[model samples]
Target chain A: MIRNEKKWLEARLEEWVGERLIAGDQAEAIRVYQGEKPERQWLSFFGLLVGVGALSVGIGTILVVSYNWERIPPVLRQLGFLLALAGVAEGMARSAGNRIAGPALGVIWVLLPLAGIGLWGQVYQLSGDAFTPLAVTLMLALPVVWIGRHASAAAAHALVFVWTIFVGVLEPGSWISMRGADALRTSWLAVVAVVLWAAMLHQTRRLSGPAVTLLLWMAFLVFMFTIAGNWTGFDIRHEGIHFVVAGALTMIFWVGEGVLGLSGRRVADVGWFATACFLYVLSFFHHGVGIGGGLETAGLYYAAVLSVAGVVCLARADMDEVAGAGGPHVARVLLALPWILSALLLGGDRHEAVGYLANFVLVVFCLYTMHSAVLRADRRRVNAAVFVLGLLMLTRIMDYFGSLLTSGSAFLVLGFLFLAMAYGLNRGRRHVLEQVERGGEA
Target chain B: MSGKWLRLTLVAQIIFFVAWAGVEEYGRANAVEFLLETRPVDPRDLLSGHYMTLRYTSLDPEGSVEGVRAAVRLEFEKEVTVDGRTWPVWHAVEKVEPGRVGDRSLSSTGGWADATVTGSRLDFGIDRFYFSEARKEELNSLRGGSFYVLATLGGDGTLRVKDLVWDREPPTP
Candidate 1:
């Protein structure tokens, strides 16, 4: 693709020179401007593979060592681990700024602390809970994260945090386990807030690339855990508190990052806030629709919350003046529109029809998403939009025609509908792309 | 960190870890050991790799009561055993929420204190027994027996599970 671009520019420059629109030297300068080498994505790709491979091997080694600790003699086992740690650490240090450093550091980043835990557990006969070792290991891994600033090190730190929480929750004797579920839920929210805050701080400080990457992943994981945990419908009353907290954090980060003109982080913040808001709106509708009931107080709350979200999204999309008419606003509206329509449709006591209305809204929303994707000339987004549209269709078919699975006519109808939609969407896509090309030409 | 600083940090980490493990071992060696009868509640912590769940009768401070309190404060009173040796034991139990549990540093280096049990359970913290993954099945089979958790109660109310004993024998290695 890059080579094609360079060739096209060279041809254009030649044409300009031929037309006497510019001097020969000017054309040469224009050619030179387009000649710089693009980034080597293969380096990054190899680094990722190496990182994953190292993690797998290191973890496998630990498990192997753990199962055979007694037969190897404590002294030999300890010496082996120490040697491994030292060798990896030294190699990682020497390989700094090299392609292999990312993976090598990842090996030590995970191994050293975990080896400490296993060593202490084996030597001290510390039983009943693994919390102490896990916590200590996590504490030890922090320096590696801060100093190494490699993706693997940051990933190891994030995994350690998750593992510590997992160990705490599993061991009833641990502090987190004894604190009860309410406290755990609250702590997850706290985790999200802290991580998000750290991410913003890292962005503001212009920290190392790996440090920034780590924070983003950490924040994303915590946010997902919080959302999934609450959505499981365990202790429904407490669910409200989680939604409120997550919603607030999302909005706060979104507005703050957006206003600061951190465009890269701003997009992520918007995504997080919009998803959270959508979930919050869904919470109100779930109970109403679950019981095959009408919109009660939950429906009203859903409308109010979604209305606020729609306003925010619309306003942000509007503020993006550079993208012209159908930019991010179309995407935001595509997200916010269905829920708004669903809320309005559920405003009446047509309780049984709520599911059908939701399905209708989803199908329409998906179609619009596909249309917007085509118009924006985003082939990836267009593909994704079509994929989601197909999924929604499959869901509808299954929901409405499950008993008709043995009927030939039902299968034929489903097949026909699928083909028709596929054909129409493809034609629409081609037309949109041609229009975009024509617009570019003009 | 640069090469020199990274090496220094590595050395520091090793020293810190050695000190932590050494101090913990010294504390355990000096701790007062008690043989508490334990009932095996479960066999393993599958998610956490290798472990055994242990339940002690003394873990319940409420003694089958229904009402839930905010917190329970426990203090040890010196008792003379049949052998005429003074031992610290939970003698006076006070359930308080308003203003009972406070920082009363009990011993040298503040190693001991009146332990507070959050909610109803008196968690002495020795609730799991670790083992190798290969021994999970072997250790799990030992759950259906009369066993005891030989624990060491540190002066600071810290409870450490020293060993899991069954049929008068501890597991090999």
Candidate 2:
């Protein structure tokens, strides 16, 4: 058992004993049994220290090699690098049984090859485009990451992967530079993000703790970028298709937790938050939405296929498993509402009506989120709900009074409303939290 | 992972690096030498450390062919000498018509190499010549001044920079 699991079990056991649901002796026995079992530490201090030391050594080595001392022949320098890599590999192999030193050596094992690739570019006076070499280095590092089974090595791998993609995008003659490839480029990035998330889902079955956390965070960051791209209007010609891809990605997050056993509360939270935020942005579009006319027929077909897949996944999923509360049927409807509204906007010309409907859905979703957060005693979600509501009120107030009143009066009204809302929300949040705490105690 | 698999992975990584270096070395050893006139476009690439981005005057096409991909023939006009080294300088030839052309050799007739015509630019993949940190300022100062690049074209049409010959003596590090 992990520390958190043990703590929860202990609390449950005390509650059961107090209610006479179980005898005190039985509770004591359960406690003793759990106490005797070995506790799994999520992170080892010694392992962290070793990992940091290894990173330092790796950076120091790269610095020394990159100095490009005139006296040392390029061939000799490369040979030195090969030797160092071999030594690190040997150390890693020998320390396989050591949980701390093995992964530490693995970090060096992964990094030396990348540094060596950079050194090769420097020595050969190769093109400054780092994409090819960085891509090659990442390919080589994958096996090391899988075999090392350490969070530090996995994190390093992910960092290099992201860097490689970044460099590739910026390289001359890439897809980004080519005309009419904007939608394709955005789609490719979205696909890459999905692949990372799929990898994270796979990792959950085999590993836990920081490795999974790092992967989740990296995947989520990329996913968020794709969502942000929809509004930033990078490719206006394919705006509708971008929304389809974003909607599909959001559905994957929702379905992954509810059906695919993605082991974290944050995945579901991310799904809800992204859906709510996207709808909230759409609500501001009072005029007709300007989805471009150059919609690819192929993209529409893809969107149809994705919509079918999403519906199937949602039908198979139990939202209660994700939401951790009853009334999962209602939760499913609420989650589907935004995507449905988005599709309506895409397929029809009634943009203003759909925009108004989106505003209504956003408010309802925020209220639902607050209720769920209170039920789960999640203070963070309650605060998030309050923040979103406050933003909505502020935007609406600015819209109503911007031209109706003088600048000074408008400022005074906005300031007063802001302060009043902040005070009211704070009090409401505190009362809800107090009720939740009391319920838990009871 | 099993010890056997881990050792195999380690060996494979070493082989990957060795193979890359070995391929470049082979290309360098067998490549035929040529001279090309280049002007520095960008002084440095921060991502790949210090390197001078070179724009080949010969490879710049006359009209816009943005986003067009085709195989291009390189034609050499004359021999140029810089600091006592003489070699043929490449000139821009017409892009190869894929099916209409009968012979592949016609595309690479007497000149050094072939390059992919991508977008509006001809990519030799050797456009950037890396320099040491001490020579950064010297290279930056060579902007707008033509320099001779001693490049080699391998059998596979890959071009590698062998050396850079400046019109005047470069400053000592």
Candidate 3:
């Protein structure tokens, strides 16, 4: 979901809740975190870690006393001590909110799963039997999911999304025709896509903006699917239309919720609806090539201009007001641009039309998003960076290898694309901040 | 069991077997071997990473009597056959023999296969044999061989191997 929409949803939820009582805005956690929070409301979360670390240390001490410390693996002993420090840090971070750099610690949270993997690996270190990594990862990630739910953020959510696929969903216990790594990568990507959409879905119920931000992700996935067409049987006419339809329906679902007032939660209902409609229109356009070429052309042309504009408007949208309202306006505009443009591009002989347009637009959108985030001093700009990079990688699908898949021209074009985007983001941030400081109602 | 019950049970058993077989076959990633008879001098996507967008000679959706090889001839009304019963597909030994050098993989009658398939290879670049990874293992068990694009669209399919090269052989350096 886009930063603005997330803000909009929170603002609206705040207003709605404030209508009845006082509302807290710790990065507007309720609007974003809802069911995402962990079940443990108790502060023992850190205590549990500390306790586990202490138990490990005590066990290690006894083992050392029972035999010689030198006989045991030094790595195991070092790990126990490190675990102790991790517990201390975690405990400290939770207690004093002043010292806790909440959002500043994203990768640490993501790598938390590796700790579990490590523990299991250590346990099964002997006799060459290593079957516990997956188990440990899942176990470790379970609490992390709870932690993410408690401490709502994009990074936290992305971490959980990664963990869930690796631990909860995919099967590695059995020997399949494909290797575990292949399954892991493929399923991991798919799970991330679904989780992102789910975030969109959750956000859409309140306001449309965040859901609209998710459309870029959808575009990214589409690009990946198309480029990775070798691994997939994702013929647009056959299977891809289903995803497009589902995406559209998802948008519509949010819109319907908002219209019914059931979505009193802060969501960009209108933005979500618009994004879905755009996806629906895009599906029609791509499929239109062999099926409805004329309608597809017209639809894509309309969508491209509108969606790109929507993202720009939303990224710059003021959210301190009725945050819910901000995202829908921007989302509607953003969804229209690419889908409509794609229709036009598809109609012509533009090679890698989706890549050129989507990549260009994504870079522009990323810069704009980062600029808005920086101007607002919102931490979402970090997420905007990741999202932009993701879109950039997805665009590589358009570049041919060796020749069709390895076009050197594409790499140069993309390399500059990133550099240019970085430049633009920096420049735009200055411009927006300057404008804001000049008393413009940014 | 009564006659009707027996018949119903028999039908159910038949359906169960067919469904089981169908799923097992479809779920499996099929490994087929192909060998090129005519080596195009120009490197056809030698370093193509990931999926090289493939074009098949038998992709003439319109029923054309043209020969299957990209550049070859087939005598008109040449009856090619697969004794599926006497020689099931497992027994079918396919290799790009000298005479078979430009013969496209085709049945007595030509058509397209319904299965979606992928290829695997052993050697690097041009010297690589294009077969599914599973099929490559199958080849390891057999003698050293070449690669081919399977001409498929039938009860089973046929292999048309070409572009023979060895792993130790250098490219046109």
Candidate 4:
């Protein structure tokens, strides 16, 4: 069940208690009754352990078979693979009703199909176009994914998406001259296609939040990695195709979220906003400050164009949020401010000034995220914000210590600071919750 | 008992695995063996696992070849002496530039006849050799010099490396 649905139910129950329609004890009983029923609670803990143990054993057996593959006769080798595949299939069938073991076996079973593909590829000496085997494996494992609707199925699906992206980006081909730029474009579009499918599945209640979230994040990272590789000089002249495709995807997803009236739209919005700002900052570092180097005019022009696209996406997403929430979102405004500042500072001669401003914006954005998460009672959001803040702090400290760390004392200071940050984050979570409860806002 | 469809799917998966493996094994069992000259690549990688990065000089297509599939036939000498032993020698028969193949001359079989030229190498499919990890050191020591890959070549141009040969002999098991 979605967290929002659970919260809405709790609030209605609280209202019933306030109205005194029934005794408080009755309300409490209802709350307890409405709690999420564990799917086969008895099979949870111990079954999970057994399932994991089975997976480990399966892995060991496969490894042993593969290791002694050459020693076995060719026909026996084929027999061994068939036997192992059947063994896993039987295990999966037996545990079909088991919540823990079913998924575990499903996940373990995915490897068998992949192993079969690799085994045959080895035997027949298939060509090294990595995508072919992966595609074949995906086809082979489709039944497992279809029948096993659990974490294992989700993982198998994720592997397919990841492998597809990997093949698109790194597959050796004549497009090698593009150094994956061509492939990156194709892969990013593939991500968009998958995400759209996931979104539709989610709307139909066939896909889980974790699955959709994983797809969205993977899509974002795949695009980001492509751009990040050539951030200083991502030539839109030759390589702008992927950025345009990514930008279109970002807009489509944002619009689709609004049209579908889906929850967790903020994840996509924030991801796009963050990616935009990242590109803008990288551009400013190259075009504005020219720190560590500068880009040619064409590169700068491409960066400027991408930044505009980012602004458009952020504005549309923010407007949608405001329209729904009945007010301007402070977090959205803060996230947008950095891009504005970077745009203004673009081509400026002030390197130190822009650098400091970008750092300040990063810290503020992190705090805003953490503070809003507290007000909203979202622990995952809070953790994500804290992680970003911690990462930025570590990077900044490391940069300073790069030249200053000549002795053990500097290392000691760094270690102590890391521990202190951890402790502070724990305390800060409590303090933020208490402050929000006291009607305070960050 | 499990859901019938789930059970059916499992059985289907098993059948698929068996059929796939059976076909591959059949091909390998019937394939004719060919040898390709190989050289050591990356000392660190050679020692890292049972697998070694392999390169075949013949597979590296020289000049330009144009076509979705680069077609080259293997020219085999009936017999040749290697060291003190007589063995069959087979190598990819790459015509430096097939004039008729490039210039509007079409073959009914759609063979290498109408193929253009480019620099991309033919994927001989023998780029890697895998063995048991226990023999990591043994494989690593072979990095000392050039070696020959005794591989099976299928009718449809599939290549599988079967054994590594040094000094015109397969390394002792």
**Model 2: residues >4 Å from true position, as ranges?**
A1-71, A128-131, A164-442, B42-47, B62-69, B97-109, B141-145, B169-173
lDDT of 2 by residue, A1-442 (tens): 8645866898999899999999999999998998899866544567556655665566455545444454568889788888888887778878878988887887777677778887787677676345677677777877777876766676666667656655554455444322322223456655664575567445533533432453455345444444444324443344566566556555655656534455556566666666776788778766566775565555566666777777676666656533534477777777777667767666656678877887788887777877777777676777787788777877777667654542344445555566567667767766766665565557
**Clash number for model 4?**
6
Give the interface RMSD values of the models in order: 3.9, 3.1, 24.6, 4.0
lDDT against the true structure, per candidate, is 0.52, 0.65, 0.37, 0.55
Stretches of model 3 off by over 4 angstroms after superposition = A1-100, A114-138, A147-149, A153-237, A246-266, A269-333, A338-351, A363-424, A439-442, B1-173
Instruction: Give the chain A TM-score for each candidate.
Output: 0.43, 0.49, 0.40, 0.47
Off by over 4 Å in 4: A1-22, A26-112, A122-125, A147-256, A264-306, A315-372, A382-442, B42-50, B59-66, B75-89, B94-119, B167-173
For B1-173, candidate 3 gives per-residue lDDT tens digits of 22233234334433433453344344223323232222222223222211112233322222222221221222122222222211111112222223334434544333222211112211101222232222223333433332222221222332222222222222233
Worst lDDT run of 10 residues, candidate 2 chain B, spans: B103-112
- State the DockQ, from 0 to 1, for candidate 2: 0.25
Question: Tens digits of per-residue lDDT for model 1 on B8-75?
Answer: 66777767766866778777776666455667665533344466677766444453322223333334
TM-score, prediction 1: 0.52
Stretches of candidate 1 off by over 4 Å are A1-84, A103-146, A149-204, A208-237, A244-257, A264-311, A314-330, A333-442, B31-34, B43-47, B59-116, B154-158, B167-173
Best by TM-score: 4
Question: What DockQ do you compute for every candidate structure?
Answer: 0.19, 0.25, 0.02, 0.25
Candidate achieving higher DockQ, 2 or 3: 2
Give the alpha carbon lDDT tens digit for every residue of B1-173 in model 4. 34566668767877776777667667577677656677746332212234666776754434555443455545553443456655454555553443324432222211221121223445556667666544554665653443777766654445577776656345344
lDDT of 1 by residue, A99-202 (tens): 67656675475558677666666555555456767777767766666666666566556656656665665454455552342234446745654564465345
Deviation in Å, model 1, residue B28 alpha carbon: 3.3
Where does the lowest 10-residue lDDT sum fall in candidate 4 chain A? A174-183
Q: Tell me the deviation in Å of residue A56 in model 1.
A: 11
Which residue pairs show backbone clashes in model 4? B64-B117, B64-B118, B65-B117, B65-B118, B66-B116, B66-B117
Candidate 1 clashing pairs, residues 3+ apart or interchain? A128-B128, A128-B129, B111-B156, B112-B156
